[model samples]
Target chain A: MKIVITASGEGLDADMDSRFGRAKNFIIFDTETKEVSALDNSVNLNAAQGAGIQAASNAAETGAEVLISGHCGPKAFRVLKEAGIRVYNTEAKTVRQALDLFLQDKLVESSGSDVEGHW
Target chain B: MTIAFASGKGGTGKTTFSVAFALSADDNVTFLDCDVEEPDSHFFIKPEITGNEKITVPVPVVDSGKCTGCGRCAKVCRFNAITMLGKKPLIFHELCHSCGGCSIACPEKAVSEIQIGTGVISSGIRDHISFYQGLLDIGNTKSPPLIKAVKKKGDGASLVIIDSPPGTSCPMVTALKGADYTVLVTEPAPFALNDLKIAVETVRILGIPFGVVINKSDHPFPQTEEYCRKEAIPVLLKVPEKRAAAEGYSSGESIIKIFPGLGDEIKKAISTIKKEAVR
Candidate 1:
């Protein structure tokens, strides 16, 4: 299953990038296949804002099953879920840990409300 | 015609220009402040609210009995506002945008729509200006919903002035959406110059013709004029920096009253904007 995770390298085994709309990097990884790669987040200026959605969509298009992130805004959260992608909400967990949690079915899916950077 | 005063950056005198210009021209003009998050325009134009209407956004409501743990609703929701766990669906109101897609996609028809109060749109009346303002309820996340309600109060007359919020976001878009003209209020500082560019971009994006009005013209920033000229942005009027003028604003008094010539200046600005808009 394809998956996306919002991970902080320090605490969460995840990709590292500058602030959304401000960052220019995306570190992608596949825990099950142990594959890792990086995609440029600076595709375009306007796309900076729509990055989360783009990343999620790209992941889904690649047949990824889940996306994990430290936090997701309401708009991006909606976009990812609407794309038939499952979302795993985590706090300060490494990307690997989050992926592990999801693999173990221990990751909690958000009923929204915990997403940040809205309004 | 309505004139909306806006700037992408805050503290750029959106309220000052909006209220002053409204009071200067139409004695009976309606002033609407669509900046529900921080509505400071009322401080200058004090009007008693005559009417108010609650604004609500639709959110998802799940019926536990009907839900079959199918997770279909959760899968359809783009906002992740709904999640299925162990034959139950959890619905979060704040994350919902009221799109109703989840309800439509729900195979079990268990997901229904509910109203979430976002804010209130109020109508107030002073001596002449009919005041329509939106007050986003505390803790409410959205301001566009309330701004839409405020814009509805424009009765299309000699003058309808709107004081918009200080950002290039949805609320600002809503405030300036249908205005015949937009008056961008800014200072003569670097911050003002940068934000004015953003505000200009926003206005242009909305296809609205706008002019720049330097609030504190006497300030030492020479870039305001240079920037406007470079961008081909019109500078309608320059209000020289004056202590008495600042005092009036500080005391919540209209600048036109303190400086009688301001009324004429604002009137001219409106005419220039209209002529340019039609041209």
Candidate 2:
């Protein structure tokens, strides 16, 4: 299945590169075939408030079936849901750890979010 | 008459101007603070909310007895708000937008809809100015619902000044929509200029007539004037970069009270906007 992961680019490390809205890129991965591609989280050539939806929608247009992010805002969540994508919040990590967790089925997919105060 | 004060970025004096304009009107007006995420206008106006209404939206609640372990709800849900693990579909109410598509998409007809509280819209009065504001519930995703409730508090006769949230996003869009005219507030700085350009584009796209009000105008920046001249957008008013004014704001004093001419300027602005709104 097609999937999108919001990652803090800590250079493929276990620690999250940064907080939400500060992620370096949204990495779109494939579960069935294990392929991966990424889109920059930066909007307007700079970090913006909540680029998750734009990133996810771009991924969905490429047939993303799932979205993995550190956290997401309501606007992004609404758009992703309407696009028929599943959202999962994973452990804080770099892009690679997130994808690895997803491939190993170790990532616990959650509908409830720990993200708050997202504008 | 409702005049909306909106900025593309925060700390551009939306609340400061709205409160000042309302205080200066010298009439029993209402100041509606639509910034639910951080409704700070109340801090300056010091209005105590007298009435409040909860804002709730419908969200899907799965009835496992009827779910049948099928992943249709999960598959159909676009937000990943519902997931089937083992034999039950887990519902995340916070993430749900209450679109009801999931209930309709479920062949088993197992999912039901329920109300989830996101925030509250409240009404209050401070001296000559009546106040209505929306306070978003922590952990809630939706804000426009609360904004709509706050908008309903206006009586349509009294002068209604709206203190809109920062940014050119959905919340700002909802608050600014249907306003007679919006006062684009900004600073004379590079960051302010960039954000104001975006704000101008947003208002223009929405087909609303807007003019610029340069707050802290005396700041050491000429780009604001240069940009306005280039864009041909009118400069409605200019409040100099005065530290005393900043002190008054922090100390909760309305600008019209300290600076008498502000009320006159705002009245002029209202007249101008009224004339433009008719066209």
- Which candidate leads in lDDT? 2
Tens digit per residue, CA lDDT, model 2, B48-154: 77898888888888777787876777667666566554455656676566678889988889888888788888888888888888999986656887787788887
Return the lDDT, model 2, position B86. 41
What 10-residue stretch in candidate 2 chain A is worst by lDDT? A44-53
Instruction: Give lDDT tens digits, candidate 2, residues A4-52.
Output: 6665442344344333344566666677776666666666124232344
Q: Which stretch of 10 consecutive residues in model 2 chain B shows the poorest summed lDDT?
A: B80-89
Q: On a 0 to 1 TM-score scale, where does candidate 1 land against the true structure? A: 0.72
Q: Which stretches of candidate 2 lie over 4 Å from their true place?
A: A1-119, B155-158
DockQ for each model: 0.07, 0.08
* Model 1 C-alpha lDDT per residue in residues B1-279, reported as the tens digit of each score: 778898877887788888888777745688888889978778888888788788888888888888777878767776656655335565667666677988898888988887879998878888888888899999776688778878888865666788998888877898889888888989999888888888898898888888898988889989989998998989998987778878988888878877768899888887787697732
Question: Which interface RMSD does candidate 1 score?
Answer: 8.8
Report lDDT per candidate: 0.72, 0.75
